[model samples]
Target: MDKKYSNKGLKIIAAEIQGSSKQAIGKIIEENNVGFTVTKGAQGPVSIAGIPHAVAFGADGKLIFKGHPASEEFKDVVREALRDVKVVKENLGGLVALGDVIEQRTWTNSEGVKMVAAVTKIDVDKVVFRLQKNGKIVPYPISKLSEEDQKLIKGMIEDE
Candidate 1:
């Protein structure tokens, strides 16, 4: 497999096609003259919500496509199938709605005092943390903390 597309962590979905539907997909592949292989397996859960199945399409034994229900290259086919369905616009901002408090523990320089903090706001470069006791907001530079400390802090916050 080509290293370029053979990401170990990449997710894939596989499905078995039979009858007329299989013939249609096969015709498309044959028309395109792209090499591919099919394998048999039990259906499994999909990482993407809307997608239900995933498969791998390889050319010359190298993976070129991956995703659920449709190979990456054939995603448009799946999209067209779902075109008629009305999809509700999800409020991305509402995913972590305000007042949905997540308790996090932090270490204070004043001593190694473990303090509870609330995640008020999170951004790419900085995080807004407020002391749970008095609600005092403090900003922490993400670069300042070591990876281990970050994990520790994250674990403490999620523990509660």
Candidate 2:
């Protein structure tokens, strides 16, 4: 275990299950010169799949293994967890979402007052859109918009 995961910033715990001896674990740690925080035995034995059970946790707090630590599956899982740890150390931020979707709808309200807006949302009784003049959600009632615009808005409501 020391040779495989030395200097790899992994919080490994060789826990004792079923009230096992600590000498064996201690001997192994001493021989390997393993730099671990806690090599002590648990207060009470944990009964999972019997005594010796190894569990690996990734940097993202996800489980990697819960069985024998010396198995092939454990090695593969540890490698993957190491990769995740490395990636997390290098923080990732999302890229810009520029002009993904924009719609220019010409809306005319009551008293023949016309206005051009970027339609953001169309609801059952109102159209919530960004006014072209100033970027703000303008809640224009469906009853106030022009007849043709009302038909389109009603279609949107029916589609939902």
Highest lDDT among the candidates is held by which one?
2
Provide the lowest-lDDT 10-residue window in model 1.
Answer: 1-10
Q: Assess every candidate by TM-score.
A: 0.27, 0.39
lDDT of each: 0.45, 0.60
| TM-score of candidate 1 relative to the true fold | 0.27
lDDT of 2 by residue, 55-149 (tens): 77665566656787678998888887665332111111221112201255567776788887765666668777677788776777889878877
The reply for model 1, stretches above 4 Å from the true place, is 1-101, 107-114, 152-160
